[model samples]
Target chain A: MEHPGEGTRNGGSFVVSCESVSFSYPGSGRPALSDVSFELRPGEYVGVVGPNGGGKSTLVRLLNGLLKPDSGRVLVSGRDPATEPFEVRKHLGILFQDPENGLVAPFVEDDVAFGLENLGVPRKEMRDRVAGAIRAVGLEGFERREPDTLSGGEKQRVALAGLLAVEPDILVLDEPTSMLDAAGRREVLAYLETLRAEKTVLHVTHHLEELVRSDRILVLNGGELVADKTPERFLSDADLLRENRLVLPVVQRLALEIGLSPARLRTPETLAEAILAKTESGTRAG
Target chain B: MRLELRDVRYVYAPGTPFEVEALRGVSLVVEPGEVLGIVGGTGSGKSTLVQHMNLLLTPTGGEVLVDGVDATTLKKSELRRRVGLVFQFPESALFAPTVEEDVAFAPRQLGLDEEEVQERVLESLRALEAGELAARSPFALSGGEKRRAAIAGVLAMKPEVLVLDEPTAGLDPATREDLLALILGLRNAGISVVLVSHDLDEVAEVADRVCALQEGRVRAIGTPAEVFYREPAQAPATVRVASLLRESKPEIGAPVRFAETLDALRALQGA
Candidate 1:
């Protein structure tokens, strides 16, 4: 709901900024990330996409102070994460690819409260926050359910609720919906659409369609920041998508393969309309 | 080899307060050398159903038959050898240091001589286009390579049937496409494939028949066009597009695959 570039970057404030960051795993031949630099203005929903080994996860780990960059710096709200991990953590909440792995507590309510407990929040306030967070993710009735027993969608929401309880400034979600089925994906994406209005979100995913609404899209390939463009501009380039090993959404791919401009027809309805218009014109011309 | 499940029922933690019926009398047949796609939402008993095919999880009630023989009477190891299961993120199960040893572990366990084990390992890696990765460490490979290596481990057993649960779950598009082609190639080589996936489009492209599960029961089972179009909202994008086109142009035929959808539109243009 919040228009990008409305009240963030121009005012000299960036929620997340990386400066010439480079990192490599120990004993690995190639650097996982090389000289990657980007900045996220407040309330900007950015999607990072690339091939599997292209360092999307590495960048996420670097942003959260989980891995130190071999060179360059990562800043959260202008504070260095390496020197101030706890302070940085308060501003960054990460929902890993596997929600089951991220979940620590047995019960949903207690899982949401785990973060607040670590923050040393008062007991009385923790209860309200936990309830609010659970409600935020639409898990109201699942408060007492064991996380292991819930459906995949519900478990993902529970993991999200845990993050929401902390009220972090930015949310870094790494393939949050990849493990989910169609219904589960819809559930998580719907919640994120609402959350994006208030939170600076950096979503990393292999599925490009999920980034259609993203304010900006960043492409990483072979450990480099390959492209940074608006979603419309980024997705329209069939060559770019192919070069990066990213596939277009079904409708978009259809549009491309059918000799139509990929940018013009995105959704199923529009594609159908375009086909109809083209056929009608062809019939008339013939 | 034909794999058949007759009224298979699987209950988790049976007879306990926390018991949950994961599969309730689900029945299906996997024909020889055909791709049988199993699709459902999360926790829809898709995984449970496939596990039953390989005897990973024995059905609590009813029968799982292989080629008209009851599965319980068949030796468990022999059943596993006849049917290989590749779980979701199967790469995580790779433990041997080198990709070669990891792939050879199963064949070696079957008491195949080292010479034959080495031959099977090479053949399996070649089948997955991962023969070059044999000397590489499993931990050092890329995600797609790791997946291929993991699958090669299953293929080394030379099972007649392969059941892959969400093979393309987290893969990039190119890798996903390659894996789908590999599934089809397996079928061409006289190996039946039971593909359990949440990706309907890919399933539509590869599956000879599709089985949709809803709440541990068969919601629909037929060709992709029959099952997918029956549930329009849940159908593959091509099928959905064709259906939408039909609203205005009633002549537009429903297409289950991408190429067929394009052909249908081209026919309209030609008309």
Candidate 2:
């Protein structure tokens, strides 16, 4: 959690900065978010996870200027989102929790082109952008297909393509894979991995496994920032995760139960290696 | 009670340009006091097959028998009352101002006396541990509370069997565990449960029997241990870990549950 005024490190500039942000829905008794602060470095993949209604969505909305904070400042790329929303939006693209809600056009290509058309980009350029986005999401052949008829995974890919067409530098996704099945989840995650090199992603999800590779994780509880650390440190604290109503990934939980350090065994492959090492050691000891 | 589907087949917009075969010759049974977990990928006809269980959609072909009586032959309302269907995102089903009113709506529609309807409402809320939300507006309640209230609406009808589609979707870990426990409680009380979910871990935990669906058809059906450990695609993460271990030590069985996997790992450590 670097401070907002801190000089840039490793030649990566701060893409998003939130300072003492707080917000409450109208007529609601309690605030939805309170005194939340964090910084997103360029090309950094950060995961936001918390219980439902824990302000994860609200925080992202503030970052995108969709919702103005009640008491604090939010800056996207050194510009105040509340005051310079259009300028901030130019560098940011967001994918919401429900893919159906984000899609508007009946056909896939139309939906992907809708944003570009709004920007009044020339027809030729729009065509190239749409095609490139569709290819990026692995939906090149689905250009004319009806979005409603496509499976959940394909529909999400179309939505992602629509976002990618704008060519934003930062990507904010709120539970993008929550509604999909196992195969669909795998597909979306796999596609996202390919973007890690070129994009700064702020991914909010309930699945802990999805965050295993994240550079940093922010844990929210009851509308407050509870923990900000590397994903390994955040997930290794079993009690902290349970108290915040987050479930550990199944393989990670098994590793912890067997007295293995989950921080070291982040993935199934590493868990297998640790087990094999233990077996070889036991054979030699005998 | 036993609910059986014999070679059930369903088609969407049949004979039209948009015609698509949703289910093809799917057969399964839900015995009384048991949880039948259905697992499938998207577009697998899991939702379509469950709709057939309660006659929400009469099969285009084959038979759906509710305790030996053809569901298609029964009145739609009667069949629905016997087999309560909870759709995915059950919170959308809540429309009444208050949770109590929503829960009582189904019983009142059955022409039950007002006193009986009131009793059913309270009982249903209690069954789901949602009695505290009785007077609250459904829209004002949190996501988890609203989901429980919606489920209570169907439970108030006192159905013999319950069908839930992706009941745990979009729910947090704690809320998911609570709902799973309630489903098991319903089974213990002799209410058959047909749970359709994509979460293999949850199915492995609560299901006595499991069925896998692929491309609108039944791919496999057996006990949870059999179905999950056998299917690599639908296996839980714990089972996958066991599969990796088994690659090195064949005698170390492919354990499906956390406890079994822990025991296997302990055995490896000692060996």
Candidate 3:
């Protein structure tokens, strides 16, 4: 029913669209999500963060069609996920924060191959895809080992290998580094950065420091979209950010709080250029 | 002393194929009024090392002495009365449906009377400022609220020492700063606190004594300033500025640990 070669793009368009969506788990009076709307084009990396459980995960699940919105519509590749759930799942790959829950194969190679095999792919083709995925995650000669034997980063790599083997156009990660130690988080995050090409990524996390590298950030508070802007613009709003529970990388926070404009947020050289660019954009808009 | 670990070592799956030694020969003591911070990259054995102080992890090769009692010999029943360990997202550890019940878990586990447990729960809720949410479903509270509820569960036990593992991991900047402020208040009341985290700057800011671990060994240990006080050879941008001018009175610029502004660094140059 599925293969790496199949695609949904008719003439190239957005991979996801969330319109006025709100969700609430069973028996919970408060809505987990509130009036949210956004469009994710292909190959765009967007980081979603908010106070813990402010509907980051719920919203991402809506993007790929994992959780249907209670009232609003969530479309995947121009199709309502609720109407075509199976088809929607085929085009997107998900990687949760915990590696233990998503991966099932005993051996590294077997685990990666598990996803491909589900599609009933030919054995030779599945083998090739598995190798390519493992190589992408930078794990060589780790095909036969059990997951427990691998280190935290390595196991995540294997889980990623499994996700990548499916050849999805978009990847959604749910705090893949939350359980890892410092070095392991760096390794996984660095690896994800390299995978940014040709794959739309929606990283759900509250770690403000981790969002600096993202192209854009969406901040949620009590199921409300409080801020939607570039990481620099988001961080520059020093007073506004204080109301939420998220923290920024220290130096960045200080730079922003000290009157550095969004454009002047990077290093001094970039800061100067950013200041210039901001003036230009502001003037152009004016 | 509130807590002490003279020499503690922990090995995971001893004598097996997965015989990975976690903590190799560690020693430290938290005085009655000290806030000790532990910092390390993942697998540096910080978690394994902290668990020993509260007897969460029985020392496999050494001794853990808490409040003059060697944890190596005390039963868990006896140890629960003295030391309390609050883990990351302790809300996940909440089994009771309601907030009030969850806070009363530890006290009830100690076989306290119902009235005493109720009183402890009330006091704990008041201390964490979640007194208003006691009857509500803990699962339904805000993220910060849930975390506070989890801490209240431990506080109800009324232990002398509190050990938290990455207490502010998923929280936003504002919530994290607020939560840490409350914990600092608890420390002021003489609760020896041991905080284990990966953020060096955070530990540098609040910890009286900071310990950095690497590859199953303690790399550096001393007062927070002594351990991370140097211009942080591998420090972030702010720390580099502070370290660059350590010779001058050094009024400011210490990365996440403190103020990171050009005012002090520039002031130093002018002076």
Which interface RMSD values do the candidates have, in the order shown?
2.0, 2.2, 6.4
TM accuracy, model 1: 0.94
> Cα deviation of A3 in candidate 3 (Å)?
32
**Native contacts recovered, in order, as a fraction for each?**
0.69, 0.54, 0.39
**Top TM-score prediction, candidate number:** 1
TM-score of each: 0.94, 0.91, 0.84
* Residue-wise C-alpha lDDT for candidate 3, range B1-271, written one tens digit per residue: 5566665777777886656677888877788867888877665777677777767778788777766766667777667667788876677777788999999988998888999999999999998778998998887776678888998998888878888887876565666777678778889998888888765556656787878887778788887656665526534345543554454344544433555344553343344
Q: Write the per-residue lDDT of candidate 2 for residues B1-271, one digit (tens) a residue.
A: 7999999998886776556788999999999889999988877888888988888888999999878988777888988898999987788778998899999999999999999999999999999899999988887666667789989999999999999987876677888888899999999999999998878888878888999999989999998878877866558777777777787787778677677778888888887
Off by over 4 Å in 3: A1-14, A64-66, A98-117, A121-162, A180-183, A243-248, A257-286, B229-237, B244-256, B260-263
Give the Å error, residue B223, model 3: 2.0
C-alpha RMSD of candidate 2:
2.8
Tens digit of per-residue lDDT, candidate 2, span A80-194: 8888888777788888765766789977999999878868788999999999999987787778777766655567788888999998889999878766777778877888898
Error of 2 at A252 (Å): 0.5
The Cα error of candidate 3 at residue A112, in Å, is: 5.2
Let me know the DockQ for model 3: 0.35
TM-score of chain B of 3: 0.88
lDDT of 3 by residue, A1-286 (tens): 0112123444456477677889998788889999887766687798888776688767767766667789988777777877787677667778865565666877899999987887878989998999999987767777876776554446667888898899877788877666565555667778788878678888887666667788878777788877778876777676667676556665555445544454335433343344344445655776
